[model samples]
Target chain A: MEESLYREIEEIIEKYREEETPLLCVLQEVQEKFHYLPRNVLGYIAKKMNVPSSTVYGVATFYSFFETNPVGEYVIRVCKSTPCHVQGAFNVLQALKRELGLKEGETSKDGKFTLEVTSCLGVCGVAPAMMINDVTYGNLNDERVREILALYRR
Target chain B: MAKTLKEMEKAKEKANLVTIYLDGKEAKVPEGITILEACRMEGFHVPTLCYMEGLSSWGGCRICVVEVEGQPNLVASCVTPVREGMKIRLSSRAVREARKTNLELLLSNHPLDCQLCDRNGSCELQELAYEFGVREIRFGGERKTYAVDMSSPSVKRDANRCILCGRCVRTCREVQSVCAIDFANRGFDTFISPSLGLPLGESVCINCGQCILACPTGALSEVSHVEMVWDAIEDPGKFVVLQTAPAVRVSIGEPFGLPAGTVTTGKMVAAFRRLGFDRVFDTNFTADLTIIEEGHEFIGRVKKGGKLPLITSCSPGWIKFMEHFYPELMENVSTCKSPQQMFGAIAKTYYAQKMGIDPKDMVVVSIMPCTAKKFECQRDEMCASGYQDVDFSLTTREAARMLKEKGIRLEEMPEENFDDPLGISTGAAAVFGATGGVMEAALRSVYEISTGKTLEKLDFYQVRGLDGVKEASLEINGMEVNVAVAHGLGNARRLLDQVKAGNSKYHFIEIMACPGGCIGGGGQPIPTNLEIRMKRIAAIYEVDKNLPLRKSHENPAIKKLYEEFLGEPNGEKAHHLLHTHYMPRERI
Candidate 1:
């Protein structure tokens, strides 16, 4: 509800005013700016675009990439696809969970780390892949996963 | 394909006919039509579930799959267009087996508790299961179970019983344009839910219950008040009084095996009497009273330079829609309480005091053809007489079910009139069930009162029928009063948007939330589509024509109520009891 946030949202909405399918693009930009889609911001966008709030919420929940809840300072999405599973992705997931002291989709108490198990990150050639923020780490083992977490912690 | 001699004889109708083989018989049909339409034209009955008549075809449910020649896979006939020389088989051995497999998969995830469901007999999915003779589940699997949502006073949502057909989702978005609910999440976890998975009561749902009518199963239903009514009736110290809405009299017979639109008013009353109600009254009496209040409000607004266009507030769904979407126009809406609430307010004060019955012990039950009435009766302001104005409200379907549970056949019961005092209503009250009935009834009284001359033709044909939006102009006392009538929330939105934009040029408007007014309300009989709604509208008009007193102002009981109790139409006591207020709501 801050003045700056309102002005920024208005600017984002204005940028996609001419696009054919602007809702998802507008939502992605908003999410990128705020780390997640705020509930009140979704309602604001619906009012701005003359669309129902239900529709904005529907599109927001339909895509897994968009998060409605706030993420931690660092998000760890371990790949759980077939190729990664064959390469001991479960061990990598357990390592990350133990290192961050958080279960899947849970943020740590200090809000420093969050762990999630996602589908294929499309780096199956290297297998046992994981994504932190936007960086992808492949051929990951238990020790390498802990080392990656330590690097982020520093 | 082999061309039969009899098929050739049936194909010689038109010169431009296209030839297609249907079930190996060479038949000629029209060009550029879907295979389902072509098959239907050929006198073939192809079963369908998700394919509604007016909606855009969604081939989600493969129950209507048919075998086509040279096609490797069976095609959904509802979405596939027919081509010239296309050979189609509606019921082949392979097609039947594939349909059975598809249904088995749906049933595997579906909970098989039809006996305990609300839509047990009337459900489309249940009927298809019976047709397929699904005895045992060949493909048993883990079923999807969800907690039932009963937060809304009007609707109840059970996600476990949903078939993921998207009928309710489409109906909410396409027909009503409320868009309060939609398909959320991805495959396997996909279910129909309100926006952000909020309870329907918290969402911008008008509680229209059209989704309940569109649902193919028991996933969506009205929040029932049947048991509460039964408990009140069983209490020895309580005097239970019943009031049936005007729309209920015309459509309540559908669940009792009588045809749609059958006017079972007399039998409905008799059934209520047999059900142990001490008094059986009519909501039409208060519907007439609404005319007096709303009509005066309109004239006052026009004369005093108040809000130009006065809108009717009979429908709670429409009232909520206006509150959420068009809050700026709240002043345009008439403050008159709906007939159901008006009847309750009068029943507790005037009727109870007359009979020397204590208001606390008098339980007023309303049998309405609407689900929103259930929510309307529970509003915080409805208790104008210390006790709750209406103790309970039951839908037409619920009332019929209670009658059947008591072993009472509506058709077998003899004709009986509504009880005295509160039961007497005029023809103007009877037409309140249809879409334009409110506008016509108001004009019938308003025109006569203003001009001091009777209307020769009581029927205002211009404002009648199933049109989504209807407009008419009347000259009362040399003043041109332009009026419009809109039924269905989608149409109401369109009309209201025009009004909000300052483009509307009417002095009065009538808006009903359901498509064909209260007769086609959300809680009406199952299969309440366009055709059935039209029949109910016709029956409403027929009831109007047969009555001797055809104007609200001429109703002696209403006149006596004003003479003895409430002094005038918009008097201090009348406004206190008969009028209500509205508040703006969150758009989300």
Candidate 2:
């Protein structure tokens, strides 16, 4: 099953072989298709692209766009870098942690939500920002976090 | 002593101050400070190779170049001083390219010998090469070649792999004040060498071996005594024994993925036992022995009017500095060999006779955090027994690499105890890895001897710190004893100057060449800085404080060595085995 999964990832990667930014584009495509980039796919891409495994790991680790492990139905990413920090991002993170009942980098026991802190989303003027699933939520506050998290609950 | 506040205020007004931009934020820096200093104050780090604290900046390696908006080219921030309103960009494309090119140039000449190089994993040049994305060396040039100089007892110098960044020269001159090593010849043929191109041992070079720490590559390393040791072990006739320095326990863990300064004393012993050594000992045992010898020597000096303000000769780097810069004060140095060598000398003679093993057959391997002990073990005077005392000396870093190669994870192993007699130590021995540890250890013993009573409170809080120079005075036996301690060669020079000028009078003084005693020794690890050194020093002290015993005089193993082997601490046999003499260095 793992070998077959690698074969499918390779096919998806080869689909955009000629693109200049194949890594970024392919990574985006794979994430859009599977919700999270698989570790084996990144390893396979590193071998096929002739790049260092560390470099590929660094790229995957650096941007919050990629994930090497599985995520739950809803992945909540709170901006925690300097700009967001100045605009009460800690409160937003706390709100998410309280709402989802999960700490940063941890998934809820029910597999309904996963929470994380990211560097930035280039939305400093909007103050505290978060990305829930595929859509970005800006100008977030403690109450707004509650309202957004309420929409995701069963 | 101050006359008035107005006079002090006037003096403060003369201080130089300059302002500069760091990542767009402005920082005020003192006038004579580099632009990098200003940037660092604003929490911006400009990566550098040729810049070391307490050493003069030589803009040779372009690693720390930054762009000034009005300036045509990037300036090396480590050397270039900040001007008022000067705007600098630390993350510019041109600056990055220059650094990348510089690394490429260095790599082009550097031999692809990383696999076997002692500095392989911790090399700064290798790290920068990877960081700059150097896929290949574009330039093709004939690499320089010269015979590897292992003539010195302490260090080995391989000129082939030298980057000529002048770090060793700066460390030798500006920090150590030795000036034994200097850049020789013209560009393209430029290399670091002793005066008149003599081998290090033959020249005025002191066997301090601090250059081993300053060097970025395998150009300067401790001569490996491992081959001779492996032979002794393979012969099946020898009883191979190993002893490790105190700092080794704290810093060796880093190479095995354990955090730096994590105490792994028990695990270290377990690994040594697993390595097939017949007995695993602690250099702390002899560090305790050093305190007893050095303490008695101090009392003898005070009573017999031999020499006042006796400086420690334990650090090979400081010993070299005295040979070059303070040759007249060579008499002021303690005559005892460092704990590592002292342990080896005794193990071959006293311990050998006790264990019923032939001195020739016994292999004494010392695991030290010092590169200088590599030279110390090879000294002509070290062989008190019929055979050479220490067959091989491995740095803490090297030992860790060996463990990794053997697939022994320190974290996986359970904590174990050291072998019976030679492995026992006191808090005094354990603290020898931190700054001012020797002075504190000596006081613990000497103070007891002076008072004719045991000390309940062993901690000498006054001297136990990370400061460069620490001074204290104590009243013992109705007499005042003044002591001073300094770590790092640059700091040692400052303390030595006052004593030389008759401005200060210290009965006993301790100095370690590296920043924080053995914990900050040159052979320990890379990125050994103020913060890291402090952490390791704290770990050493923690090991000391947690130990059940805290005084050197109380160690049962040391007492057993005296009773069953050497007879006494400073006995004739002890002197023959452990003590060594120094010589006047020649003009550079």
Candidate 3:
């Protein structure tokens, strides 16, 4: 709850105050600004919008895109869909986990990388795909995953 | 929305009629009515699990599916609107098979521990299973078992028994406007949980227990204090005393096979005495005490400009709601403790000392028509008697169960009177069980005290009814005293929001957390719909009409207690024993 963070949340709420069904947009902007939705910020938005905190929390937890907890600077989400699994996505995921020394849904000790398994990332053409901080790395094997991890190490 | 039978009848007069076929019988019904309403009007009982009268239609269970002519699949009757000449087969073979299959699917994941469940006999799912002749499970699978949440003092949550009807969610969000619980996850992992998956005790739950009344299963129930009460009564060193609330006497007869709104005050007293309570008192005694203290505070505020529009603090649920949602208005709320807490405070101190009994050895138990009373009695501020004032609080339902467990039949018991001093009350106190009763009772006393004259007409009809909000104005000694009454937390929120916006123009306001007040409390009998609530309210007025003393200020015992012990209303000693303060709470 830094002063700057509070000011940013207040600005976001003011921007969407008059829009119909503004909860989703307000939450999306909040997540984008803070990297994850903080508890106090969510409570502040609920009070400003005159909506129940439980309703806001419900919408937040219902969708997978919204995160309530903090994540690493670079979040790596490995696709675990049918097409990706057929293309040996497990090996790619294992390689990433070993290289980063992080388990699934865990952030690294240095807060540099977060490893996660997600449903289809909508890039099935490039099977065994993974995304890190908006950059997609697809057609991956152990060597490619290791190379991908090394690129972000510095 | 699913309209009740009464609402449907009212709509039939104004709306155009549509002819529909039910089991090949032509029936004319309201144009915009649902198939379930048509079935009910035609005397065809279509079974349903998720469909309630006044709540929004959620068509989740699919148990009320009916075959419509020319439709490929059976449509849920609860959600489908009737059309001209639409043929509906309510209990046909296909419909019955679909319902049974739906029940089997629901049971596939539900634990079959009905015999040991708290709602075994009265469970809607259990009743439906019996009606559908579902003796054996056709499909077996891995059952979902969740750890029960017993964190809250008022309500318990067992997600394993929930049918995902969403009734409790709707009741909390739509009716009470306290959206503390909702569907958290997606698909099979979905379960009702508080905000951020916090335990209910730590959430913004007001503990009104309206959700329990809406739940068709035992997934949500009152946390019982029966074991503790039983232990207190059986202890040789304890002098266990009981106090029954005004609302409990009118509604307790429902669990004993009696119709709703039956006044069994005498029988309730007899049953408690037979169950080994040393004395059976009335919370109405302290309800009378509340009026004396609160009415005086109101007059003082008006005269001294202490605070205008003094709000009542009789309902703990309403108090908690005010704390979380309207914290700024907490200063306007009355400082008097609720009648139940006041009785506990007085019983453990005044009564214990007068009767030559040690306060430690005296256990004060209260029988209330509320779930919030369970939480209210345990509050840190309620221990005014140097100990926990009220040791345990039980609901009317729990009291009935205890009576039955002791083999005491309420109908067969001889009529008896309550113990002296703490048992006697006025007709105004008797009406405290219903919505608007507090305002009416206070008006009766306030008007007389201000004018120094008796009131010829006792009933204040303007403030009495099932309306969500009620307003009335009275001129007392050339000064207009405007007042408003609101029941149900949703209605209270509306009124409070108006007050917060500086739009309120009243001198007093009475707010009850439950719809129709304590008679329709969360701990009342099951099936406590609008119809039953009205009946219970009528019975409350009937009790009031028959009583000799109708004003709280005129109660002989209360007057005696004030004259003998407490010198004056809202005095130093009375404030220490009866009044309390409030604090703001986090919205999350």
Clashes of each: 0, 4, 0
lDDT at residue B302 of model 3 (Cα atoms)? 90
lDDT of 1 by residue, B116-146 (tens): 9999999998898889988888988788879
In model 1, the Cα lDDT at residue A147 comes to 83
Question: Would you list the rank order by lDDT, best first?
Answer: 3, 1, 2
Instruction: Give the TM-scores of the predictions, in the order they appear.
Output: 0.94, 0.73, 0.94
**lDDT tens digits, residue span B105-183, model 2:** 8778788778888888778888888888888879767899888998777678999989888888777666555566677
Docking class of 2: incorrect
lDDT of 2: 0.78
Off-target runs (Cα >4 Å) in candidate 3 are A73-154
Fnat of candidate 1: 0.60
Q: What is the lDDT of residue B542 in candidate 3?
A: 94
True contacts kept of 2: 0.00
State fnat for each of the candidate structures.
0.60, 0.00, 0.65
Which stretches in model 2 have alpha-carbon errors above 4 Å?
A: A1-154, B1-32, B320-327, B494-504
